[model samples]
Target: MRLDKFLKISRLIKRRTLVKEVAEQGRIEINGSVAKASSKVSAGDELTIRFGQKILTVKIQDLKEHVKKEDASSLYTVIKEENIQQPTRHE
Candidate 1:
């Protein structure tokens, strides 16, 4: 599945357009490399997302065209999530 669609179908980013934008801006990575919105994804691929100051890492468990809200978590496994401190202005 396409990276952007996977993100939405999996309920990770909440919207396909947002996911595409994120991918285009290089905020999303696959297998440790910057991924494009059209990148193909499959099972067992690692995905890292940068959401503001927080980072989320997950491994793709499965890929489906559609999934229910209650079953969204089954699509991937959260490997790690961290809120790393970033340099602030006026130090």
Candidate 2:
């Protein structure tokens, strides 16, 4: 499945366009390498996504074309999620 579609269907990003934009900006990666919106993904692939100040890493467990909101999370396993601390401004 394409990265954008997978993210959308999995309810990770909530939208396809945003996924594409994020991927283009190099905020998405697959297996430690930068990934594109059209990048091919399969089961067992690890995806690291940076969303603003939070970073989320998930491993693809299944690739489904369509899934209900309640079951969307079944597609991937959350490995970790962390918030990026911003540096404080100093005078």
Q: Which candidate tops TM-score?
A: 2
Candidates' C-alpha lDDT? 0.94, 0.96
Candidate 1, TM-score vs. the true structure? Answer: 0.93
The candidate 2 region of ten consecutive residues with least summed lDDT is 12-21
Angstrom error of the Cα, residue 51, model 2: value is 0.4
TM-score of model 2 relative to the true fold?
Answer: 0.97
lDDT value, candidate 1, whole model: 0.94
Residue lDDT tens for model 1, 1-91: 8999999989899998898888888999999999998999999999999999899999999999879999999999999999989778995
Structure candidate 2, residue pairs in collision: none
